[model samples]
Target: MDIQVVHRPGNSAAKLTLDAGESVTAEAGAMIAMSADVGITTTTHKRGSGSLTKTVKRWFAGESLFLNHFESRRAGSEVWLGTPLPGDMTSMTLQRESLIVQGGSFVACESGVEVGVGWQGFRTLLSGESLFWVKLQGTGKVLLNSFGAIYEQPVDGELIVDTGHIVAFNETLQFTLTKAGGSWLHSILGGEGLVCKFRGKGTVWCQSNNQRSFGTALTPTLRARSR
Candidate 1:
C-alpha cells in the first residue's frame, strides 16, 4: 500500500493506494472517498483474536470503537481519509516498539498495529490534561493528526516541550512532567504551565498550536455570539 498526505498544515487528508486483496484499517468516519472497486467493512478486529475486550480498550484510548477496513478487489484501487481536526497529519512506520500518542491526535493505523490505553500516574494531572495515552504497538503505519503544524525533533540528551503542544513520542524515551520554571509562582506567571522533560534518544513530535488553549481562548467569543 502507498499513502500520500495532501493539504498539509491545514485540513490534511490521506490518499491511499492498495494492491489487490490488500486491506487497510482506519478510524471510523475518517473516510473521505474510496474507489468503487474497494470493499468496506467495519469490525473490532484486533489481531490474535482479541474481540470485545480489545475494542473496549481502543475506545478508552480515544480511538473509534470499531475500525473501518477497506480492501481492494482489484489492483491500484485508492481511498481518501481525513481527520476531523483542521491541522497536519503525520504518518510513521513502526517496528516492534510502540509510539505513545495523545489520545485525541490518533487518526488511524494499518492492521497489525495495536491500539490501547496507557495509564499515567496522578502526577500527570498537573499537566492540565487527562492521564491516558494511546499506546500503539506492533509493526505497521500509524497516522497521527494534530491541531497545528507538526514538528519533529530528534532528542539525544534532554528536551523540553510544552505538555499541551506535544503530539506523540517514542515509548523508549523517558519523560517527566513538571512545572516549567523554578517555582509555582514563576510557573504560573510565566505562561508556560507544564512541560515534559524528555531524556534518552528518540524523536518527539510537537504541534505549533495547542488545541485546548485555542478552545479556551475562543470560548468567550462563542459565548458572546450565543448570547
Candidate 2:
C-alpha cells in the first residue's frame, strides 16, 4: 500500500494506492472517492469485528460511530480521503509502536494496525475537549488530519503545549494537564487556559492553529440562532 498526501498544509487529502487484497480502515464518511472495484464495508468496529463498546467510546471522543473498511480487488486501485476541516494531513508508519492521538484527529490506517480508546483520567476533562484519546498500536501505516498545518516536535525532556493544539504524541511520553500560568487566577485572566506538559523523550505532533481558539474568535461575529 502506498499513501500520498496532496494539497498539503491546506485543504489536504490522502490518495492511497493499494495492491490486490490490501485493505485500509478509516473513520466513517472519510472516503471521498475510490476505484470502482474497491470493496467497502461499514462496521461498528474494525473489519470482521462486532465491538459495540469501542464504537460507543469513539462516539464520545467525537469520532464517527462506525468505521469503513476499503479493500482493493485489483492492483493499482486507489482511494481518496479527506477531513471535514480545511487543514493538513499526515501519514506515519508504526513499527510495533503505540501512539496516543487526540480525539477526532484520526483518518485511516492499514488493516494491521489496531485502533482503541485510552482514558486519560479526569484531568483531561479540564482541557476543554474530549477526555478520551484514540489509541493506535501495531505495525502499519496511519493517517491523521489536523485543523491546521501539522508539525513534529522532538521532546528530549519536557515541553508545554496548549491542549487544543496537540494532534498526537508518542506513547513513550507522559502528559499532564495543568494551568498555563503560574496560578489558576493568572491562567484565567491571561486567557491562556490549560496546557499539556509532555515529559520524557518522544515526539509530539501539534497543529499550528487551535480549533477551540478559532471557534471562540468566530463566536462574537456569529449571530445566535433564534429559538
Candidate 3:
C-alpha cells in the first residue's frame, strides 16, 4: 500500500492520502477530507459539532466501519490512531486481541465492544497474559508526529531516560522513576533531579527537547526561575 503525507509540519490540518484498502489510525477528530472509496471506521464515542457529519460522509462514500473510536478500516488494511502529538492523549499498549491504553480510553471496531479502564479489562477478554500490546492491524503505512526530533538508543542492559524526553518504548523493557546523580543533594544543587531508569533489553526513544522544562526556561527571567 502507498501513503503520502500531504500537509507540512505545524499546519492546522494534516491530510494523508492512502491507496485503496490501505488503512491508518489517528486521533479521534483529525479528519479533514478523506476519499469516499477509501473506507473509514472507528470505535464508538461521543462526537462534537462536526465530527459525526464528516465521518458519516466518509462512511457513506464506501468506507467500512470497524470498531468505533479505537479502530478503523478501509479496504484491505486497518489503522490504529496514536495519541495526538500536540494534544493530551496518553500512551497505550496492545496485547494479543485486546487494546490497552494508559490514562485514556479506547473504542473497538465492532459495536458494543467492552471498553473500560485498567489492564485487567483487556486481559479478561483477549488473554490471561499480563503484558501490554499494540497491534498494527493493516499492511499500509502510517504517519506519526512528535513535538521534536526523536532519537533511538540501543540498550544491551540498562539506560536512564529523562521522563520529559521519552517518546515511547518497547513493552519488553521495565522502567521506574528515580532521582538522578548519586545523592539527593547533588540532584537538587546540580538542577537535574528525577529520571526514568530503564532495565532489560530494548530500545528507548527520546525527544531532542523536554516539552515542559524547555518552555519554562524559554520565558523571560529564566535565571531567576531556574532557582
TM-score of each: 0.90, 0.97, 0.51
lDDT by residue (83-104, candidate 2, tens digit) is 9999999999999999999999
Per-residue alpha-carbon lDDT of model 3 for 1-227, expressed as tens digits?
A: 33333233333233343334333444445454554455554543222222444344333322222233322244433233333344322222333233222111121222222222222233222211112222222122323334455466776788987655665555567666666789979975776666668898777655565655656677776556454
lDDT of 1 by residue, 1-227 (tens): 78899999898998888889878877789899989879888788553445686677667656778777888898899999898888999999999889999867877777768877777777877777656687889998888898889999899999999888889999989999877889979998998888899999999999999888899898878746544
Candidate 2 local Cα displacement, residue 182, angstroms:
1.0
State each model's CA lDDT, in order: 0.84, 0.92, 0.41
Which residue runs of candidate 1 sit more than 4 Å off their true CA positions?
A: 45-54, 224-227
The candidate that achieves the highest TM-score relative to the unseen native structure: 2
Task: Tell me the TM-score of model 3.
Answer: 0.51
lDDT of the structure predicted as candidate 2? 0.92
The segments of candidate 2 whose C-alpha lies over 4 angstroms from its true place after superposition are 48-50
All-Cα superposition RMSD per candidate: 2.3, 1.0, 11.3
